[model samples]
Target: MTTRNIESTDAAGTVRVTWAAANARRLARQGLTAPVDGGPAAVTGAMVGAHAQVLSAAELSVALRLDGGATRESVRTALWEDGSLVKTFGPRGTVHLLPSADLPLWTGALSALPAGRNPLPQSVRMSGEETDQVVDAIADALADDDLTVDELTDEIVGRTGTWAGDRVLDAFQTKWPRWRQMTHTAAHRGALCFGPNRGRKVTYTNPHRLLPGFTPLAGPAALAGLVERHLYAYGPATPQHFAKWLATPVRWAAELFDRLAAEGRTERVEYEGGPAWVVAGDTDFPAERPAPGIRLLPYFDAFTIASQPRTRLFAGAAYERALAGGQAGNFPVLLIDGVVAGVWHQRRSGKWLDVTVEPLPGTLTAARRAELEEQVERTGEILQGTPRLTVGPVSVGAHA
Candidate 1:
């Protein structure tokens, strides 16, 4: 890719590009236009990380981007066997499968984030000193072996004081150990990550064990690097959008964007008539619009979550139909030529998978219907099942 702007207008040097051109570039960058020739790690890295809150969805997200006959098992192998991917807390404090090699960048940037307000009562909340002690104990407890939540709780209470074990923190219909509040913090500090499941229970282990000698790259430099990577995958984005994606304060994101612009590390542009920023040299939008096609994106897919200008991406009926309220990724989406135009669902039994697609009234032509069928078949291949397509109403609710 060239560093020079592809199409510029006026002496002010703002690159002019339409949403069509921008979407084409984004699809190519995200490995959505065609299957990329690489392993799960490369696809995960290109997209920053796959949203692993739903592990099956995350696996499908990566598998759908590969050129080879990659399956969900490919993603599992990378996480459990090859050690190329680490399951840890990522953007917005959600679970993500990040490339092991990029742990330094992720940990460094995430650890530097400004702390959010604690919802726990003062009596149950840990002080700064107490939080630090709990984080230390967590690191030490996971350094040698993987432990389930209950086992880890016991170890943590033993390592620290009884105060750390107080079951006062409110959780899903129950209370948890006060120290459990720092689970995401421990991961951000590069002290913890997911281990292979023992039976049906989840396990936690130290990231240092995954990648020997791993250490986070901290400070402003690391944050700047993260911004560049974000722009690479989803550029022409505003600080507000970046803040939303990272779950940070808009003011903080604006200050960082200003600093990056001042340092000549990022360039401001007029994207579809609105001001936005892209990496200084990454101003090359695709000259041609993306070809008309269909794709099935699973729930909580990274592309749907990270893409910006949501109003445009989810236009017309899509705004209300594909999205839950105003939040993206709650429902599986059907993409027509790169924008969400419908919704879909799948049910599996034995070796057969039934796929249902509900497209906007006139969105699907005969050719597009054929493409949708092919896409459904591809989805079945990734899931290791035989697919049967049904182009009708998808009556299920969000995330059902």
Candidate 2:
């Protein structure tokens, strides 16, 4: 693929860059390509974390990074067996598989803020005092033993009050623990994290016990560190986009952005006529692109979901099809040369894994077509299955 990186500064101190449309493919490849050779924790550190609401998606997300070097079982081992990764609530109040050692930074930065706006009306919401009590109850209950959500809810209501047992939220087609909403609160506060599964049920434990002598940064320090990490991986973004991705208020994101700019930690640039920020001194725009290939990214894979400015990544009808409802994780995406090209799905028949792709017609070259087939086999290898390939639409994901 022909690639170009153009950069210029006008006298008024504004930066402008225009890339041939193919540049979109190159820039994304730069950002999304994983250092799979670096292992699971390295992959987690690079992408921040894997969207883990679906355990299988999280496993596939990390396993795909291996580029066939590892499998779903290897990723699971890292998270459960090796203790190198931790499943916890990260940005946007979602569960993610983050590096175990990064808990201090992740929790310190996230919990410094309050839990999200309650979907329930104010009358039914947990009060600040009650919320704090729930947090305390969670920390206390899971100090020595991992407990399922039901068990923890029982303990929490018992410790706090029967009022805490009232239904407050619904998710994943079931009523969550009244304290379930606060579980994210507990996670952000570093009070709770995932334990080995108790059969089919998910369980929670205290991260403190798993990671000893952890020294969490103070609020401001952690915020700065968090922003830096984000910019390092996904920068040249506006504060508003940052806020949206983090699910924080724009004022909060802007305030942090201002601080980073003031500290010489980041610089402003124009991306498609809009001003954006990047880590200072991080302007490395190489002349050539990485080897072109296809990646069948898992649902909510960091690359597919986290990158922003829809115009930059999606072109023409590709955007409308790839994000049919403007939702990212609803389908596994076919990323050709980094930019999203179409949607895909897989089905299992005994040991055989049948894969399907719905491309934007003419998007795939003979070489990319070959790479797409290779990616299908790689997907099965990562999932520890065999592979078959078919092109065209296939129904998949929860949205369908």
Candidate 3:
């Protein structure tokens, strides 16, 4: 629904949203400290989708949220055995483990969004029509069976012609055929989803196979639903943040935010940087705050990726060390008191997980130190492993 315009609220009045409060609100809203009890799907739903570029990271993302010390085995069982979660392309063409039941909202909202502006010059660039053709070809080719990237590429080129294969994307200091790039667009179009792995190879399948009678959101009706969900999880947000999170153009994101406001589903509020929007009646700041705890967030956790501003995430030099490229997926972060306090790494050997924490040159209280131990123990329990920690100052900055 195209909303006329947002009602004027002069929101940045009376209620002051300090950066710390914004962070705290987000921490509570994301179900980080107090995860919902509906199993992995619930955690995934709250997160929108857990980044799965590295599969284990995705599993831990859910494990840390569920009750009863959920483990990676549970995530595996849910995906491979239970069919409750499906891996697919999320915002920015990245792989994410999405709740199977929510495919309609994801595909519908995603497909409606704009494509990336490829200004890579003609030699390596693809035209808009070519991209669309590739997306359609993929949807048709994968109608029945799962296909590896090679198999899908062959089918796609066969249908769309060899020109579709001529374009290229560069990564790891090497140029690769561009056919793989269309996978995200294919996913956006509901044409492709991750199939169970074949040995060491990753494969793509039709999401409909897992979600019977699945269909893209019947227009923006689904997108409107997603807007509500996004705001609920990461409200007090600006159009730019939503745009970045969805990988949609800023203009398009702004349009969606405006539509929500026009519908009275959202209201303006005074946020740290500027005025922002939140789900209506969400102005209840300090609503029964959840006590803060230590959490070790995996790379690209939705919590880190959702909001745009980082001032609240990091205080000073910590921002530079934690987010050098202004990207969230670079490394795992340590969350203490609802802010990024350090970085950590895990090495699992047999039944024990060797954890190394590198803080931002600060000291934890005696209580916090004990709490950190408890948190590490919990992390081990969630992974179904034991914790052997090496706690000391270490360099874990983005590049380090």
Candidate 4:
């Protein structure tokens, strides 16, 4: 019988389909909060954020995907070949680092949408052209001066108008760098700083801008590629899933998928009785293993978004709905084998790192408990034996 018939697709069964997916999806991922120094989280966050911890552009490409620790060959190959992983201020304007090659295509699609309109009043607002001018003004100012968002916002508002408080500050200081960083980080092959001055906090920007020379692909090609990549990375997924991921209209996602199949960039796959698309790959079957164990996952990892009908991976009934809502503010999940067994949070208090978890329904066996302890030890090692660390219970539930 095919592995699809089984409730749990183990490591052996999954490897053939995609090797990285298995390594990426641990039994239960560990959690670390701000001030919890050391560990893969900080490095991973920085790489994906595309700032500080500089590596050769080439090394950055592979490192973003956790391909290998910073290496000249791996990073360079990713930059030249696959495109560096670019973090887009995407969807509801949240940060997402995606494959750099997709930037031009993604941005073009985004520009076609009606601008959501800045909420500021007319006197305070700049026309589209003026907004562009202001962004240009800010960029040019930063070309020589790395002013903090506050500094930049103050200067720009002072130069152009008043009322340059929190909203204006956020737009210039926070949002601008994040949006531009995705385009300019790798494009310029340099960093964008929080302030114009050196030694200030650094925000990563790709070397390129979204408009003009990036010269996005035409509509058909752009939409097609977007659909293909989405399915390629997250498959056995529905149009609704793609719509949410891309923040595109449901109809648009459906149309794009149809176009991809028509173009042969994707092929339809079966999930239960439903139709889903997958990028054609030589691998078959997910890795094989039992359904019980411990794994820890990161925030916004692809594993969490690949399929809308998460019941394929999550063992419980309400697991999908509950987690999706909670994800808006919290991450750091705990898994028992293949199932989402709990949720966790971490924070640093002085020298101690406080970690807490709320388990999902189901009793964790003694062996499973032991397995969890070992994983935490491994996380401690990854953090290079931090100042201090502790994990405990806050509130946990099991979704039967």
Candidate 5:
């Protein structure tokens, strides 16, 4: 079925919708309208994965979606103690919290991406054969035990060669071991994942140990499944949006979407003023207008990062205030109803948390102010603090 088959449209066959209605449907689908009754794993699955570049924010992202009063501690327990979630390099080669059960699909799809150009000089870069050796060595090294970076490097050098451990690659003002460049690749191949921290140091272990018998699904099928999941979570989106979200080439994403459409797994629809794709039979818009609610989503929250048609979602003053250089999620957003209306910042001291909100001029009403208070309280609860709200200029820089 396509948008043509849907009711209430213009003569052009486009299912024209208000931005509010579209955003409301997206919010409901993302478990933002109402908290879902499931644990962190379920919430993580729904989001595909929570961005974990900022671990605390990632925890809060999952906690906020849960029905039971879950906190950062709850998410931490799931990751380190309960083994329900796995920390690994996900889309865009950044750390993410993924459902441990779903690692196969993530690994397969991510590994299938066409290799990006290597920035490292040839003197430091490994040959394809050497890279494979390092990856296999990493898997073998972590198969039986977790290892810190230093320990893992030793194991890799012993298993492969001294060349693998040469500190030649420039990183932040220091040099990193040559083999370290393939860490994300190892994760995408289902061979490595984060281990519980040892003191203040991070460690790596084989994902097979985390999920016994874990094996990545074959690439083609896994990539198709990932596309379906993306459409479900952030649908009525364009191939360009998908390409950006996955850090893949637009040509690749466009071709994949075409294949899905050909197979009757997806359908094209007119969203905003452009063509977009959604999962077949999943194009129902909300009948009721959205309530004037407010939400304070943290930096790099999955919803803020993954949602499409940024121009519409970050409209008016939001385009200038909330975004950083045309990028979303650089600032914690103040979402009114569904679209971003403001930016927010949180500073914690002792047991008290100070939240500063800067909404677009004339956007906040008394009702919305009350909703903002409630959202601040919820944010405090998720962070285990007492919230103090300030409705004024948030004088903090992006990602502060």
Candidate 6:
């Protein structure tokens, strides 16, 4: 099948595309992308990302336009209906979601990792027999009681044999072991979630089983479905992105995307000036604005990492700082006129969310400056409390 990328449509460099039109195209291209209207009737379900598809809960929620107050019901709806959450490959030996329904196609396009490629140093590496035993031990121990990752990890290490070294243990467990317990959930849907070490009241769930699970995948088809879903929402991505997101290798992702494309089960679009593929069929771009008004995208939002080329979404200079490490390093960002203007952080005070904007090296007209502050106020309202804004120093072009 043929694929298409964006071509210069007009005389001037600007593409006359309406932001709204672009938004629709962008969202539709990835079937898993959804808008969360406040409602109780939305469909939702827990996604068990297989090896091919892997995504963080935060990633899934953001792509679905879900608010911080989103309930399990809302998450499940996005997963089951919009098909955004899939069990696809990603970072640190875990799975993540992309879109929906695209999981299978994406999985099929890639090849699975070799049976025995461990990144751990030889000193701490588990022998084949020991690795098997460790997995078995965890499966047996978790037969009852929902345990935290730390608790389960400690038990596994203790029961395995002896503490070889700190590095050895770190290499062995990595993130997979925890992901395994979380995703498997055995007979239950709940897995061990991670929270700050002390005096913090926050926790997040992971959905992968590095070893085995209570409710293990019925078979390979289930896993394939998860992978396809990922591409549906976060497609037009490189195999590297998939590997980074799924903690798999580029070879596996490349194979999967190729197969899906051959089967006519996927479509390609121009993203960041490259041919990008998605499991969903052809879709149109958003006509006018990508979304209604200025948006305060949360940390790790899809817009942060959706396109393979980070520069497309972020300013050339700010994008560098934001991605000094890699895509995993998510900095909360600001968007004006469908472009990255600056980055911001929130300071929560009881019922208020104060946003501090980091101005770029440009001058802003008085009206435009007011518009930016107004957007910040609307953000405060959406956050449901008093809102305060603080603007920072100005720059050359847009003047501060």
Each candidate structure's count of clashing pairs: 0, 0, 0, 53, 0, 77
Q: Please report the candidate that would top lDDT against the real structure.
A: 1
What are the root-mean-square deviations of the candidates from the true structure over C-alphas? 1.7, 2.8, 4.6, 9.1, 2.5, 8.5
Error of 6 at 172 (Å): 16
Candidate 5: tens digits of C-alpha lDDT, residues 172-246: 999899999999999999989999889999999999988999889999889989999988888778889899998
Per-model TM-score, in order, reads: 0.97, 0.91, 0.89, 0.62, 0.94, 0.61
Order of quality (TM-score) = 1, 5, 2, 3, 4, 6
User: What overall lDDT goes with each candidate model?
Assistant: 0.89, 0.76, 0.78, 0.44, 0.86, 0.45
Per-residue lDDT for 29 in model 3? 57
**lDDT (C-alpha) at residue 50 in model 3:** 91
Question: Which stretches of model 2 miss by more than 4 angstroms?
Answer: 1-6, 12-14, 17-34, 114-116, 168-177, 397-400
Which lDDT value does model 4 have at 295? 52
* Tens digit of per-residue lDDT, candidate 3, span 1-400: 1111122334454344555556666676577767777878878888888999888889988888887568898899889888899899987788899889998988888888776677665677666798888888887888899898788888988998987776477767866567666678788778889999999998888887898788888657878888888878787788988887877789888888888889988877767647788788766555344458788887788888786586667667667766757777677888887878888888799998988877777645667777788878877887778898877754545522
User: RMSD in angstroms, candidate 2?
Assistant: 2.8
TM-score of 2: 0.91
Q: Kindly list the per-residue Cα lDDT of model 1 for residues 144-209, writing each as its tens digit.
A: 999999999898899889899989988889999988889999999998899999999999999999
Give the number of the best model, judged by TM-score. 1
Q: Better model by TM-score, 1 or 2? A: 1
lDDT-sorted candidate list, best first: 1, 5, 3, 2, 6, 4
Evaluated against the true structure, the overall lDDT of model 2 is 0.76
**Pairwise lDDT winner, candidates 4 and 5:** 5
Question: Model 5 segments beyond 4 Å from truth?
Answer: 1-19
Q: Residue 162 deviation, candidate 3, in Å?
A: 3.4
Quote the lDDT for 264 in model 4: 67
Question: In angstroms, how far off is 220's CA in candidate 5?
Answer: 0.8
TM-score of 1: 0.97
lDDT of 4 by residue, 1-400 (tens): 1243223244433322332233122221111111212322333333223322223221322233342232344433443334444443444445444445455665555545334435644545544554454555455545544355556656556554543232421343543322222222212222222211236454332225322245555666666655655554445456777777655568867876777667767655555455665665412334454354565443444444344455544546435523655342134467665546666644456545455555665646656676666655544333323333234564533221
